[model samples]
Target: MSTSVPYFHHFQKDTTGIERPVRFTFPFCYDPHELSILAAEQVQTYLAGQNDFIHNFGLMDGQEGLVIGKMFGVLVVQDQEGNLGFLAAVSGKMAGSNKHRYFVPPIFDMLDPEGFFLREEEHINQINRNIELLQKSAELKELRENLVQCKKHEEQILSERRKLHKKNKAERKERRIAQQPCLPEQAYQELLEDLIKQSYRDQHHYDVQKEKSTQQIKLAEDALNHILDQIEELKSERRTRSSNLQNQLFDQYHFLNARKESKSVLAIFTESKNIQPPAGAGECAAPKLLQYAFNHQLTPICMAEFWWGSSPNLEVRKHKNYYPACRGKCEPILGHMLLGLNVDDNPMLENPAADKELEIIFEDEAIIVVNKPAEFLSVPGINVKDSVQTRIQNRYPEMDSPLIIHRLDMSTSGILVLAKSKDAHQFIQDQFIKHTVKKRYTALLDGLISGKEGLIDLPLRVDLDDRPRQVVCYEHGKPAQTKYKVVSIEGKNTRIHFFPLTGRTHQLRVHSAHQKGLNCAIIGDDLYGKRADRLHLHAAFIQFVHPLTKSLVQFEVKDPF
Candidate 1:
C-alpha cells in the first residue's frame, strides 16, 4: 500500500443525518457543504493542538520568524470500500517542509535534498555570490571613481583653453579694426600676417591639450569597462540558466483528472492561455487535495478552503473565514482536475435581474431619474446584456447619447440618473468629477456598533487573484472615503446611512468588512461577507446641478429593506 493512504482521516464524530451533495462543490464559488465543514473543523482542531510542526501563524506574541497566515483545505471522500473520510492539505509549504504527517504530500517535492531543483538552485546561488563579491571589491570601486574624475578633469581643461582662445581672438579683431586706417599699406599687411601667425599657434596649443586629455579619459574608461563587461556576461548567463530551470520545473508538475488523464503545468497553461504557468501554480490546497484523492482512487464528494491566522497586509483575510479558490493561479489547474466529475453550476453566469423592472421616478427633456431595483445591472455584462442602459435606449429610440452618468453595484438597489443628451451628460459628469454631487446610501450592517457616526478613510484595490473582490491595499490603491451614521439597532443588525466622498469599485463594501475600517460587513454582501437574499445597501439620495436649468436638483428613494 502507498504511504499516503494513512493520511486519510476517518470522521471521529457521528454523521447520522448529514447528507451527501449530488455534485462536487464548485471550487471557484460555493457555500461549504456540511461534510466539508465538518472535515475542516476536525482539521482546525488538529492544527490547534499539533506539536509536530513549527510555523508562525501570528496567533502568539513571541513567535519567531516572519508571521505568515496560510489557507487550508479539506476534501470529503469515500474509498473503494465505501469508508467515509477526508484528506487535509495546506497551500504551499508549512514549517519549511511539504512532508507533514496529517496532510497530503505535495505533488512535486522540490525541497528534497536529492532533487534536481535544489541542485540547480545551488548552482544559481554560487553565480550570485561571485557577482556580489566582484561588485563590492575595492579594485572595481577605485576604477569607477577614477573614470569619473578623469572625465571631469578633461572637461575643465578644454573649457579653460576655449575661453582663452575666445579672448585672444577678440583682442586681435579690435587691433585690426583700429590700426588699419592709421598705418600705411605695407605696415598694415605685416600686422595682419603677424595676427594670423598668433592665431595658428593658439589653435595648435588647444588641439595638443585636447588630445592629451582625451587619451587620459580613454585609459580610465577602458579599465572600468573591462570589469563591467565581465559582470554583464555573468548576468546574461544567470538569466539563461534561470529560464531553463523554471521550464524544467514546470514540466515536472503533472496534474491528473478524475478520468485518469494527465497534463503538465506547462502544457495545461499553454493550451488554456498560451502563456507560462504562474508562480505556485499546482501548490494550492485545492489542487493538492484533488491530486491525492485521484491517485488514491477515492471519490471526491465536496471540498472547502479557509484561512487560519492573521490577515496579510496587502489582502483582507479574516481568521476561520471560508474563501473561494484564487482565479490567477488555481482556476486553470482546477478546471483541468475537476474534469469527469459532476460540479455545481457557476452562479455568476446566471442573470440576477432577469425579472426585475426599472421604475422611473422623474423625467425631463434633458435627463431621467429612475429607481433601480436590487439585483439589477446598471450596465451590460459579458454574459448578460439586459441592463438599465439597454432598457433606456429601447424606451426612448430618439434620445441621443442616453449616457449613464454613474453606476451602482449590480446587487445594490438605488436611484440612478441618466442623461438624454450629450450636453446634459457632460454637465452632470463634471459635478461628479469635481466632487460637488452629493449621494447618500442606506445599509443594514450584520453586527451592532456603538459609535453613532465616524469617517472611514481606507484605500481600496481589486484583489488580482480573485476578480470582482476588492482588498484594502495601501501601497497601490485609490483613495476611498466614507462617512456613516448609525440610524437604528434591530436585533443583531444595525441600520446606517453612508455618505460617500469618493467613488471606487467596492469601496463601501470593503470599508464595511475590512478590519481597519468598520470591521462589520454589510448584510447580504456575498463577495466580502456572508450571502443573503440580496444586498441590503440602497442609494437613497442624489443631488446635482441641472444641465438646462443650471439649478441644483435632488432626488430621493425609500429603502425596501
Candidate 2:
C-alpha cells in the first residue's frame, strides 16, 4: 500500500474558500484495564504546550465531554471547510491557552474501569445478571410446575390407599369375628369367661384410680387447711397491729388534750385567782403560763418542776395527777401555793425553753402559709433536717404527720404553702400536677438583654455525664419553655419577668446561660453561672384556686432582685 498521506487539519468552518491552522491529535477510547504507560506518555508529550479542552468521543450519552486526561499540541495552517474544522480550531485554541496560562499540558483524565471500587461495581453487575438469568430460566419454570404436579399426584395416591386399607382391615375383622365356632354352652362359657375377666380388670382399675383420687383429695384438704391457718395468723397479726396503733393514738390525744386543759389552769392562776405578785411577776400571768406550756410542750415533770420548788419536805400527796406521775405526786395545797403569782415571775415560765418560735404567716382551717427565711430549705431535703418541714413538725405537735405538697429552693425567700387536711392536700397537689397553678418569678441576668420580649423554646434534659446539669438536645430532650420579657435594664444587669411553661428544675437558669450568642445567666446562679453570693432570682407571685372554698387565691412577694 501507498504511504498514508499526512492529513491537513483545518481550523475554520462555515465559510467558503477559507483556510486556517488547526491541530490534530490521536483520539483514543480505552477501558481502565486497557491503559498502558507508553500511551499515557505519548499523549502527554503530544499535548504539551496546549490549553485544555474536553471532547467526548463515546457511544454513551451524557458522558463524552467529561475530562479524561490532558495533552498539548500546536496547530499548523491547514486547508479545510466543515463544522468539524471549526470545532477542531476552537478546541485547539482552548487547549493552547490553558497550557500557556497554567504552564502544563492539558491532560484528559477519566475514572479507571479496572479500579478496585469499579471492580466491586462490576462484581455487583455480574451478580445481578446471574440473578436475572435465574429468574428467566426455562428449567426452573418447568421444574416448579413438575413439583406441583408430583405433589398433587402423591396426595391423591396416599388418600386412595388409606381409604382402601381402612375398608380392607374393617372387612377382615368382621370376617374373623363371624367365622368363630357357634355352640350354646361354648358361647355361654366364653361369654362368662370374658365377663369375669372384664369384671376383675374393672375392679383392679377402679381400686388403683380410687386410691389415687383419695390421696389427691387428702392433699387438697391439707392444702386448704394450711391456707386457712395462714389466713388466721394474718388476721391475728393485723388485729394486734391495729390495736397497738389505736392505743398509741389514744394515749397521745389524751396527753395533748390534758396539756390544753392545763393551759386553763394558767388562765385561772392569773385572772380568776387575782393572785398578786412581786415586782415584774405580773408579766408571767396565767395566759403567759399557758403560752409557756404550749411552747415547752407541758409534760407532767416539766409542769411540776416549774410550779413547785425542788423541796423534799413540801408534803406533796398524790391525787388526780398521781397516776400520770411515776413516783411522787405534788400536794394540791403546795401546787396551789406555788401556782400563785409573784412580782419576780420566772422569765423561763414566760418564754418556753424551746429553741425556736413558729412564725405563722397565714393560717386557716384548710391552708397554712409560712414565710421561709433565706438559709432554710422550703421542704425536707436529704435527711429532711433544718427545713420548713421540721419546723412545722415541732410547731404542730397536735396534728398527725403533716404532708408537704410542693417545694422551693433553699435560698429562695417567698410564701410557702401547706395543706392541713388530706383532702385539701390532694386538691392542691392535683392542681399543681395538672399545671393549673400559675407561677411567676423575677430575675436579674448578668447582661443587658436587647430584646423587649421573647420566648425561649429550647428543650432541656438532664445531662447523663454530669449530674444536676441540664443540657440542650433538640433531637432527644424534653420540651421546656419559658416566656421572658425585659422589665428593666439597669447598668450591666437586666431584670427579666419570667413565666415558666414547663416545670423542669433549673430551666430558666440554664436557658439564659446556655443560649447561643447570648450566654448570660442570672446573677448568683452558681451551677449555670459565675460565682456570686446569692442568686438574684425571686418567686414574685403564685396564684391558684383555693381547694376548700374554690375561691381565687393569689399571693405576691416583693421581688428581691
Candidate 3:
C-alpha cells in the first residue's frame, strides 16, 4: 500500500528517433545527500523482489513538512540520473555545496520551523483583525442599506403629507362656504387625531433604524471576539515553539491582494484616471495597460500560467503548487515582475531608416502591404531604428500610420500587411485568429524532393531548454498541418510550395525536418537545418476579407530570391 504522487514523467528517443514515455513517482520530500544512495538501494530491492525493468529511480525537489512535532524532509529515489550531483537542497540547506570559507551561514541552515510558527502566529492575528474590521464594515453597510430603503419610502410619505396639507388648506378655504359652523368641534377633533398619527409614524420609522443598527453592532462584536480568540491560540503555540526555531520569528513575506475594479476612461499617455494600485504605477511586471489598470485598483482580468517559456508573466497560481519547495514557488522569490507596454511598445527597437531600406509594394486607404526583406523587423522596437512598421511610418508620415495586425519572423523576409485603421486591423486580425485566412510560402530546401504534393501532420511544442526551436511532441504538442508540392529539384536543392493550415511558432521548419527519411530542410534555418544561409521560406500569398467593404481580397508576390 504505497501512497505517492507522480509529479513528473521521463522520456527518451527510441531506435527510430521517436520519443517514448515512462512514468515514475518521487517522495513528497527527500534529503539531498542520502537521496542518491537510497534511490540506488530502492532500485536494487525492486529488481530483487519483482524483477521489473525499473530502468531508474525518479527524484524531485525537496519539500518541507512537520511530523510528530519534528521537522524533516523525505528521502526518495529520483527517476533517471539519480546521481548525488543532481541532488538539490530539499529542506534544510542551500542547494549546491556550502563549503565556502566565509562567516555567512548556509541558506538552508536558517530554514527551521520555529521562526515559521511565529510568523504564522502573526499572520493569524492580522487575519483575525482584518476579519473583525470586515465584519464591522459589513454591519455598517447593512445599516446604510436600511437607511436607503427608508429614504426611498420618504418620497411616498412626502407625497401623502403634501396631499393631507392640501386637503386641510382646502377645508380652511371653504370655511366661508360652510358658514353654518355646527360641526366645528368635530372638525377640530379630526385635525388633532391626524396630527397625532403623523407624529407616531415618524417616530416609529426612526426607532426601527436605531434598533437595526444596535443589533448589527452586537453581531459584529461577537464575530470580532471569536476571531481574536483564534489568533490568540496561534500566538500561544508559536511562543511555545520559539526555542526550536533558528529565529524567534520568521521573516514576513507580503502578498498583496489586488482589488478588482473597472474604469471608463484610459489615457493614451497616462494610465486609467480613477484607479490607483496598492503602490502607485510600478508594483507589477505587466504591460502598461495592465500596470495602469493595477495602479487604478483594477485587478487583472487575465490570468497567466508561467513555466520555462518565452511568453512573459506566465507563472503558477497560488493554489496550484502550495508546497514551499516546488521550483515554481522558488522562482518567485528570485525573479520579480518585469513591465512594459502593449505590443506596439518595442522598447528595444531602433529606427529602421538608419539601416536597410524598405520597399513598399502596395499601399491604399485600407491596407499597406510591404515586401519586407530579411533582418528587417516586422514592428518597431524600443528606439524605432529600422523595423518594417517604423520604415513605413517614417516614409509616409502624412498617411495615418498603419497598425500592425500581425507579425512575421524577424529573420524571415516576405510580404507583410498592415491595417490603416482599428476596424481594418481588428477584422484582419480576427481572420488570422480563426485560421480563415490563407498563407502560401516558397522555400528552397537542403535536398531534392520527388513528391508532387504531400501533407504532413505533426504536433509541435517548445523544446526544453531552447524554446525558440519547436520540437515534435506527440503528447503535449498542438496540432499543425502543412501541405507541400515540389516545384523543382536541383542537384542538392529542392524548391517547394508550402501551405500551412495552422499557425504555430515554427511549424513549417519542424514538419519539413521531421525524420520521414528526407534530408530536405528549409534554407537558412540554422536551428532546424543546423548550417544554412537563411530559412528559404517566403510569404508569397495572403488572402482575407476587406474590413470595410466585406469583399474578398487577395495579394501575392513572386519570390525575390
Local accuracy by lDDT, each model:
0.91, 0.47, 0.48
Give the TM-score comparing model 2 with the true structure, all chains together.
Answer: 0.37
- Give Cα distance to truth, residue 459, candidate 1, Å: 2.6
Model 2: CA > 4 A from native? 1-360, 516-518
Candidate 2 C-alpha RMSD relative to the actual structure? 41.0
Better of 1 and 2 by TM-score: 1
Name every residue pair that clashes in candidate 1. none
Model 3 lDDT tens row, 1-561: 221222111111112232221211111122112322332333233323543222111121232321111011212212223311111111222223222211112222223345454365566566566556755676556655655655555545555655766665566546534643645777866755665665566556555655665565556555555555655675665455443331222222222222333221112112422321221122111122232333333322221111110111111111111111222222222112112211122222434336567777777788888887765678765554468777667666776644787777766778888888777888898999899998898888877766789888877887542345566776888988888888888778888888889888777777776554233567766555533445577888888988878988888888866
Which ten-residue region of model 1 has the weakest summed lDDT? 1-10
Clashes of each: 0, 26, 35
lDDT of 2 by residue, 268-298 (tens): 3345445422111211212222232233333
Backbone-clash count (model 2): 26
State the displacement of the C-alpha of residue 268, model 1, in Å, after optimal TM-score superposition: 2.2
For lDDT, the strongest prediction is: 1
- For model 3, the stretches where C-alpha displacement exceeds 4 angstroms are 1-354, 381-385, 396-402, 516-519
* Candidate 2 lDDT score at position 463: 56
